[model samples]
Target: MSAEKWTPDHLQSAENRSLHLEQRRMQLLPVVDDLRRLAREMAAVVKEIDGIEGDIPGQAWMRARHVTKPLFKAADDIEQAIGDLGAFNTRYQRSYEELPQKRAEKRRRKALAKSGQPEAIESAPAGSGSPKKDEFEDVFDGLRQGA
Candidate 1:
């Protein structure tokens, strides 16, 4: 039923990989937090610029206005980095979560095969014992049945 064969060693390896990925994902949180802090600082800078504009004369502000655009651009860059990190973290978490499930499924299928039961039959309910079928046949039947 599973895509790959499983052994104890295979399951252990998958578990280890999952743990490693989870650890790496956890490590990313601090970096993301730091990026958030940086973004907040940038926002403060923008607010300061706003305050400066309100207090200073137009011509004088205009003379020093070049700094504001660059500050805003830096903020945008930090925000983009945070977005990218979030995306990476999501993907990492998904892969980590799926790895253990995949390994368990593989083990179940292998055990079924070893016990002389069809992997497909093992995957289905106990009462569904309509002879053993190959994966393709099972899939085709499901499609035909609109399941």
Candidate 2:
């Protein structure tokens, strides 16, 4: 079911999922921060290596540039994963604390039903005549008699 229509059990499950995602986000933060630092370091190293020799495309320059691509991409991917986990946590965190109360209310009703208690009828059963029949019954009779 959609998150908006979640049952209490589903809410608890969603809350657990968010908690797990939050944990994953926490674990990934340090790694991603490290990767960002490393990417910055790679940029500095690339600039340094590029300037070492004048206008000569050496093996060091080529290797450095090639390695930088994957490192930067890895950093980008980690950043994206962190963002996703954060969004998931934000979406489901409230549900974690709200479900138990809802579930209890649901259980109370279920228990009441299992006890065979008669539920109050808000409206009369179908095909049953109106309860105020006598109040209206003389109106038409009076009109006809006056005519």
Candidate 3:
């Protein structure tokens, strides 16, 4: 239907939201990468310092590595969240695309509703109900119809 050409407002809103989430994801991706990279570099540097120093300073730098553990974990969590959002959006889009014909029919109905038209009800096929013939009809009735 031509109504399909006009995307429903809710669908458009969902599309806009998806686009925004993708943009935000893209923006955050680099930050998460940088965080992970910096965390890794810091851990390496701390380990190297601990190796160069004796017990006292080595213990402090070793503790610093532990403190950075959460940074690495948080960066990983952020990356996972971004991936999850991307996957969700992919599924959302696929679900919408999968039922194009159904969506078009719904759009048609919505357009009709907006135009103040009553939806057309589908009628059952003719003679689908109980037989019109009397149940007590003579046995010859079937033979007569066949003839």
Candidate 4:
């Protein structure tokens, strides 16, 4: 008669997982944004610093800045990781929504099983036995007996 499939411990654990995922998302969103912002700013600063003609040996630092490829790639990676997590969250939501329906279906099947209705007759396997004619033979039994 119970509609829910989850035990109290299972439900509690599911809630905990959901909360943890949300917290992870919350924490990561800002970090990803900050990384993106830093990447963008690095590009612009590199461009500006390019205007300076430097005989300076610390010019290696400038070389590090002039290329935005690695920075942008890192930002893109962060975004991709966030996107993957979001997908996981979506899947979790869908499974959570479907839990009740799945439980209801299982309960219906179980109830049907327990209701003690005769199971459907299945065809006998090959060589299991000769076909039984008694079901049809009964209808002609009286005619045969009278004759």
Quote the positional error of residue 117 for candidate 4 in Å.
Answer: 11
Model 2 clash number: 0
Candidate whose lDDT is highest: 3
Would you give me the overall lDDT of model 3?
0.70
Clash total of candidate 3: 0
The digit string of per-residue lDDT tens for model 2 on 1-147 reads: 333543446434655666556666777878888988898798777867644455565766676777787877897898798787667556565555567767776676667667766541222245654578788887789788878
Assess candidate 4 and give its TM-score to the true structure: 0.44
Q: Which candidate order results from sorting by TM-score in descending order?
A: 3, 4, 2, 1
Over the stretch 1-147, how does candidate 1's per-residue lDDT look in tens digits? 134543344433545445444554565556656755765675556556544434555644453455455654564665566566556546654676677887788788778877888664658546754566563675677687765
Better of 2 and 4 by TM-score: 4
For each candidate, what TM-score against the reference? 0.32, 0.42, 0.44, 0.44
Clash list (residue pairs), candidate 3: none
Deviation in Å, model 1, residue 116 alpha carbon: 2.7
Off by over 4 Å in 1: 1-69, 119-147
Q: Which candidate would rank higher by lDDT, 1 or 4? A: 4
Q: After superposition, how far is residue 27 of candidate 4 from its true place, in Å?
A: 2.0
Which prediction has more favorable TM-score, 3 or 4?
3
lDDT of 2: 0.67
What overall lDDT goes with each candidate model? 0.57, 0.67, 0.70, 0.64
Question: In candidate 4, what are the lDDT values of residues 1-147, reduced to their tens digit?
Answer: 124443335433446546555666777778778877888887777766644464576675666565777777786887788678667656765676667877776566556657754331122224544677776888898999889
Deviation from native of the Cα of residue 23 in model 3, angstroms: 0.6
